[model samples]
Target: MTTTTRGTMHPRFDEILTPEAIAFVAKLDSAFAGRRAELLQTRRDRARRISAGENLDFRSDTRHIRADASWSVAAPGPGLRDRRCELISPATRSMGVHALTSGAQVWIADLEDATAPSWENVISAQVNLYDAVRGRLDETREDGSTITAEDSPTTIVVRPRGMHLCEKHISIDSRPISASLLDFGLYFFHNAQALIDGGRGPYFYLPKIESHEEARLWNDIFVMAQEELGIRRGTIRATVLVETITAAFEMDEILYELREHAAGLNAGRWDYIFSYIRTFAHRGDEFVLPDRDHITMTTPFMRAYTQLLVSTCHQRGAYAIGGPAAANPTRQDDEHRHRALALVRAEKEREAAEGFDGSWVAHPAVVQTCQEAYATVLGDNTCQRDFRHGPITAQDLVSLEGVPQTITLGGVRTNVSVALRYLASWVEGTGAVAIENLMEDAATVEISRAQLWQWLHHGSQLAEGPTVTRALLDRVIEEEMAVLTRNAPPERARHFEQARDVLTQTALGDYLPGFFTPYAYVRYLIDRPLRMDGPLSPDDLRQSEQVATPVTNGSAA
Candidate 1:
């Protein structure tokens, strides 16, 4: 536990880096790494008070804990109330046995932005999520088929890696620890008592939250990791994506700062439209935004941010979910799989008629079209949290009124060819990349390099003419890197030249960096050195099997 710096450990990643999971990730980096560095310097002093123009309300010191009304939250745990969820990739052991047999009640797995944090994908995605939470996951098929999970029932959650990322190949006294407390302290110290004795427990999602004092520092690191793993104290539920525009103006104070480890709230729609273009990129042209394919989720500011996140998770009972139906299903084009299953069944029937209690599908051929569009609006309902639509104010969750500010030249050359082919499949380790058919990830390359730094800091014009300069986004990134070097393949030309130097240092920098995986994880996933047992080529086993299948339309060469 006190081992100050042991960076390269791969051979059986010491069976989930044991020494009591590196002393429960060094006691959650010595009890909350200085309140996670003062909530990341209060997120760089609220982005320099929104670049000095200031204006991001909600928090007259938590407004009597959001006007207290006999608080709620701790409920739906164990195989979390159904709707449908799927987003696999615990660095692929046959895509975590095909996303725990992809029927989809829940299967997140993730390890942040559908993975590629590479320290051998952060210790082989913690040994394939500790063999898929002890059902003893299995895999094989390159055609020789195998895959297991022995009678899978789904529900696994996980996600970890957001408190502005760290795990720089694990260190201690020398610093660098919190990759969200080393992926939720090694999956709640190897699956919290085998997922609460196998009836499902240790669930989570969290990801990029902005405030509610970073969900009260993850509810004081889940009440000091369930009182140092003696378990039973709201076992550990968590959901919280709410994906930033300052956590959509503090969703009920982030469910009243994780009310006993809350379990709901998602709609992390492409990192909440890349945190509303990196928190209004230098305040100009009324928060400029247009093409991330015309900002869908039926845009009037994404239907007032998914109807104020399903009326603040059904007025605080919780479970809202829905975002990410990143269309990936062109199985040999039956008219592009019925127009990507009728655009993911009209975005899962507008998140199952705006009371979302489940949604998210990045292919297992659209998880039964998002479980029959949430079973035709939740038939034997496991959610609608008693249908509360809202008294929704705060200017309907910061209304970027009537939002279709059309800036096009084919949406700035499809945001410089999908942020240079999803940062060349995230510097070749591949953190989700279907591409032209969607499923891009790292929140669609942080909304394609924060919409090319808010269209070159608001000079934005392009509906077929000009403007948008940083010398016209460096001449449309050298004409999309010469059409990705004449259609890729030469072992993916050094990950499209390290994704054109990480999309020209985070889309032509001069401010607005915030993240492109913490400077492309210390430059291209940890500057060289520790290879352990490297050898994966054949284009790193075909970008780790097209990051668990579904890459048809324009195969993202």
Candidate 2:
């Protein structure tokens, strides 16, 4: 067997800097180093907003709007069929640091079902993830466009092990375990703070949020961290995963509680559906939806869940992110790709119709489909003249009537005034400006530079227009494909094969303390095909025998 040495240690930020970059670093240092008063004030303001039931309008605060709803942007419509696929890596050790850095919108560096458990592997995985994000220096390809220090896509998010034990969840016995939990969280928190301190604040996606109280717990910890470690507030927001039935009901309150440091809510479909079944399994007569995969967003429970989430978020003024379709990536054949594209197009169209501003895309290949979906719905610039600047009403949006943009189109001076201001923002960000249907003031052309600044530094909203074109779509595809195919490219494919092999041979059996399963460690009880009687406790393992190789083959059946 070949033994590979761990690569050289990651370079710290301070070690690689030119004089100007160093000076810029110094300024950023001052920004976080000496701002207790400002941090406190911001936190208090955010707390007040949460208290007032006003979730933040992230568009007005943060500089970027998430494409969380981008997944289903074109569903149930012309461009696609009603299909969504989960983007699974099919790899137990699915850490695609290179592929993720190359261009995909989000990378679920999974430590859950996609990974196996071993303390060294777990720590190595976490450390690997940290180093990948912390910045790695590699030579640019000869033909590859020179990526400046700034322009790489922000596309990695971790789905760490949940409370469940299927993956990397730590457990000494058959019971719930806190082992490695604190170490993992602390490491993540420290690096996350370092990232924020380096100016990319609050960019984490926390998964498995089952209740409002859990969200509160996270918030409390965040506040304590800010006070104790001196990380700035409003600079470390997280997107809470709404994956459980309890979390669905507590959505509003969860958003309210975590308002200050919350980026938005994420709809985690698979685990969510799984949890739903587990939670309500006892209610024989209860109207539980069919099994997880069979339940679409159109399913009554799912529809209500999604709509409620959208309504709650919009009502509280937070972004309503759609859930992942958990869609499959494109097949190797052209027919498969075409069919998948059609499905993607349809799904995205429906998501748009359902009022989601953005969604998730699992693969680099799928990003074009998602972007195109958003473009088809959001690209129409005709509504600019219709914007009504009057006190915006919920009813207008509900009926897609009397919306500020629509009401303002009647040539009301107030509407036009607000539209003009909005248009100014659009123009400043990009060279062109169009809101709803009006061509921006041609005279505002000079403000494009300033608008660019606003869009990059402050979250500015834009009404869709021609900017989302086929050319741009083709460009992103070409660029992303280059990244995906570079440097012995099918790297992820290798890992996928490894996982498939593992699953194919893995057997089903119980490693219970007193059970007769092979490979069961006497000290550690393990089981699969979970029994309804509940897991065996630590006491059960006291007299157990230690065994290994529980399953002779991957298929337990």
Candidate 3:
């Protein structure tokens, strides 16, 4: 097929609009069409109620709402996220119940990219994971003491096979299953509904999204599923994987289009990188240019792409989350583990600095790093102050005609004021509040308040508001105080002292020639050639203590 670029929609996609694609588009169109009139009426009614100063649940107030029933606690600081990075892994029949529930915020039991052959395996993995997470069965660890599978603290999110893996077209182990792609999504949606319903959190991650049309299609099916299953609307949310390059351009439109059903957008990096390669397959020299690690995201194109995603989500008031890099993280030693941890830590820090609220983690090890990075960067007290300004007027918070403009940092923005409230909660750790606004979700507001309170009671700072005095920013002065007071974590305390010394020295205006500063080190590393001769060795694997346990190929552990 000849490639043509016409307007915004790529022309190559025109010819490949097969029957499946057409059906997909029709499904989305039908969903919006069916709900359009009702949605408008609901919005009108909601506007009138808000105009009259009535408290409302934003989920119910919308024409359509998406997300599972599980509720999330909002954090301090506008746009601050709980560094609980999601841990996604494909559960195989061989993965013991214990392995599946190991430390992580959310364990995505995947059926799309992880599993190979067997519908039986799919069903088995699902039931096993559900049971494991529910603590119905117990499994022993290497220590001989039984690790009762009680309270698998990690949330279980499932991603059923996509059209690319439909049982009808591609047999699993050469046998056909009773379910198709649509049927599988619906089946799990129904089965998981009872156990996970109601403000707990969603358990679904929609994968391999290629276009806005695809998102629309899923929204339609989701609406139907809710109606048929008697599941409350807005009880289920989807994390759409924006893997294709095109989806990036149409992101804001897609999120706005499915605001009722979307939990947020996920940057599907692996598939996206693969898609990038496929799209420019002709560039063979660059194709073998380097493996993922060798390629620094600071590169011109990558920087633009990453920054674009950050800005786009911020502009629209929705959460702009970074995608997973899928680095192999099975190192067990502190130093090596720190290196792996450092890689992930660096990524999260970069994203946070770039203005992303949070990011995706492929392993359990990176969660602390993500959390710590956010804690260090945003600090406490970001959320305690009053941001609602003036009376909570309709014009200030909500827009009767359209959506609220997102909070902007420089040129970046977010989709809703709730995101701003979330950041506030992250910072102050307690007592931040959001005035009822048309675009603000009541749950979001409540969660933000709760999280802020939790943080203040437990955060690094005092219960009072943050005092960012000139004295506080001076590390040397603080270190001296800490040493005088003999604070805990002596090693860490010493490190701070050393950093303070460096800061003090730098302030002295003594320019030593030929010094390789930290900035220079970073630029040198960024400019260095990517080392992709082979995969990590055993020594490398044992370094990161918190990654998925010992590395294994596709084979069993």
Each prediction's whole-model lDDT (CA):
0.76, 0.39, 0.41
lDDT for predicted candidate 3 compared with the true structure:
0.41
Off by over 4 Å in 2: 1-95, 98-108, 137-151, 163-186, 286-293, 380-535, 538-557
> Using lDDT as the measure, what is the rank order of every candidate, best first?
1, 3, 2
For model 2, residues 1-557, the per-residue Cα lDDT tens digits are 11111222233422332233323322222222212223323433544453344432223221222323321111111111111222323111222533344344445455543333333344555555555456542235478843332333444445554321222122223222221233235344446665654445434456656555455555655565565456665544556677665566666667766777665566655555554433433232222232122446665555666666666555544555565433344434787667776787788778766766556654546656776776687574211112112222222211212112211111122222322333223212221223332223212211221122222222222233222232433343334334433563354434323222211111111111111111122211222222113343534322111112221111110
Give the Cα-based TM-score of candidate 2 against the true structure. 0.50
Error of 3 at 210 (Å): 1.4
Where is the poorest 10-residue window by lDDT in model 1? 548-557
Q: Candidate 3, residue 415: CA error in Å?
A: 40
Query: Whose TM-score is higher: candidate 2's or candidate 3's?
Result: 2
Clashes of each: 0, 66, 56
Clashes of 1: 0
**Once superposed on the true structure, which residue ranges of model 1 sit more than 4 Å away at CA?**
1-12, 17-72, 75-110, 117-119, 124-186, 189-203, 206-234, 240-261, 271-289, 293-299, 317-401, 430-441, 446-462, 465-478, 482-493, 497-557
